[model samples]
Target: MRFFISVFIILTSIAPAWSDETRLDYSGRTVIYHSDVKLRGSQKRDVRYSHKANFFGAVAINTTKKTNDSNGAAWGYHNLKTAQDNAMRSCRFKADRPEDCVLYLSVVPKGFDFKPKTRTLSNDAVEAYNFLVGWSRLNFDSYRSFAVNGIHTWAYSASAPTREAAEKEALEVCEETFARSQKKKDPAWAKAVYLKEHLQCRIFVTFSPV
Candidate 1:
């Protein structure tokens, strides 16, 4: 009888453990997932636009009159405008230059099938690279976004032909650029020279081409 009781207790304990691994909670405003591809199971259901009133994502930074500071990328809000405002506010509030807060990125939680027309890319490669990586685009078919933001430096690529391939290439390029900066050994040479926190790949798809 003692052995049976012990066995039963072990099974019950492990059962909850197994369930915990697969358990996904999609509560208000938190990002459960971000992808162009559809998710399986209960995660497949869409977040109604009306429901989007409670969720928003954004990045913002302080200005130096001539340039923008690093350390933006605040996320998870309800209103886009409010998100942008709060992000900029956060930057300015913590910044040496308090008056130069600016919005760098913002997006609401969109559905899986959500796709928007692609805008014209920049003619200049450098500027285009910055624009693509820093800003979110309208959903277009086969689109991808990847970025690496480190201390005082960042890089990104988007709307590539392939998903994982583009992401890998973007990260590689970003890492390569970061590595070069490390080799140069600028003023902040002693600081860590890699994307320790902000390395990510995001995908969005749209049906219409514009």
Candidate 2:
């Protein structure tokens, strides 16, 4: 009896430490997410044109008085140093003092592009969205809705012959669950949510007259 009581006390004491560590769950699988913050955007721009050779691009800014007179790809350079130097020189050419210009940002091997698998919106909602194989001739739409509370989530998905129907079904399922909670006199920590907007969905989808 003493050993069992001691074990219970020990577990209760360490419960707080376990609660601090959060886990990520998707499709019934759970994994630890060490960080809570998510990246929404960055202050960077892609090159308008890229050279076939190993080319470097850079940005230089006039730091004297926070001027918008910046320069990029002023003179094509094979090396980063040369690119940085030229960019600064170009920026200084338009500056009141030539020495006020400094390198602000740089991008190398211009042809390389980076894309994120998921996107977070301004509302602090993280989203994972993709379109299945569909065209005007044959439309099969699928959508998912989720309600989240802190680290917990309830999700529902539906597939239909049209986008509107699929979206409607997903919302109905999610809201039905919410309505049940209200009727049962049980308070819910989460609000019903819809995750339909993709940050870069238009890049992949194109509309044509059928």
Candidate 3:
């Protein structure tokens, strides 16, 4: 009985957390978006169990409006661009405004890498980095830290004089912003599941005076 209980705990801890929907930013970064409409069981299974190589897939949805045929998923394709195009085509067939159809999720091979220029950062993080570069130029003597939660959120601190203080401030700022954004997106489940499951802000870069 104890062994069974332990196994249950382990399984529960490793269970996948699936949101109602997901969104892809302009840079192809995926963001968890909450919605009342849930994916079908088969679609969810495709997303959860997709691991084959040379297989690319994508999910497209109409952001402007929701309809029975306004969202689609395509998988098991040999090419990424093909998968994306097919997904969009499927989604736009009955969409009121086909132009509103956007790729919300993309699935590549098990080892495929998106290789984003900003790496794990969102567009917001890139903007923060740019701002940090300018701020550091003016505050050259002060210690600075840059932190990101690795989930479309980031923050920086240039006012602190010590590395530890700068890191702490940056983490606090980043976590706060992350929490606020998650809560605004899905108040009911963001705090209980998403934040607790994925919130980890770490200092990625630090600056020291010469």
C-alpha lDDT score of every prediction, in listed order: 0.34, 0.30, 0.52
In Å, residue 78's CA in model 2 sits off its true spot by 1.5
| Candidate 2 wrong stretches, greater than 4 Å | 1-54, 64-76, 110-210
Q: Return the number of clashes found in candidate 2.
A: 0
The reply for model 3, stretches above 4 Å from the true place, is 1-118, 187-197
Task: State the weakest 10-residue window (summed lDDT) of model 3.
Answer: 3-12
**Evaluation by TM-score, superior candidate among 1 and 2:** 1
* Clash count per candidate: 7, 0, 0
Question: Tens-digit lDDT track for model 3 on 1-210?
Answer: 000000000000011223535444444434333233355534444344332322355666666655434465555443445455555666565467666565655655433455643433333355567777888889888888888653345678866778888888888887776566544343432332233433587888988865
* lDDT for each residue of candidate 1 in 167-198, tens digit (9 for 90 to 100): 65555655555455445333332222112342
Better of 1 and 2 by lDDT: 1
- lDDT over C-alpha atoms for residue 5 of model 2: 7
Ranking by TM-score: 3, 1, 2
List ranges where model 1 is wrong by over 4 Å. Answer: 1-130, 133-139, 186-210
Model 1 — which ten-residue stretch has the worst lDDT? 5-14
Candidate 2 lDDT over residue span 50-166, tens digit each: 222223344554554443323323322223344445555555555677665545544344222234324211111122122222322343233322222111112223234444444
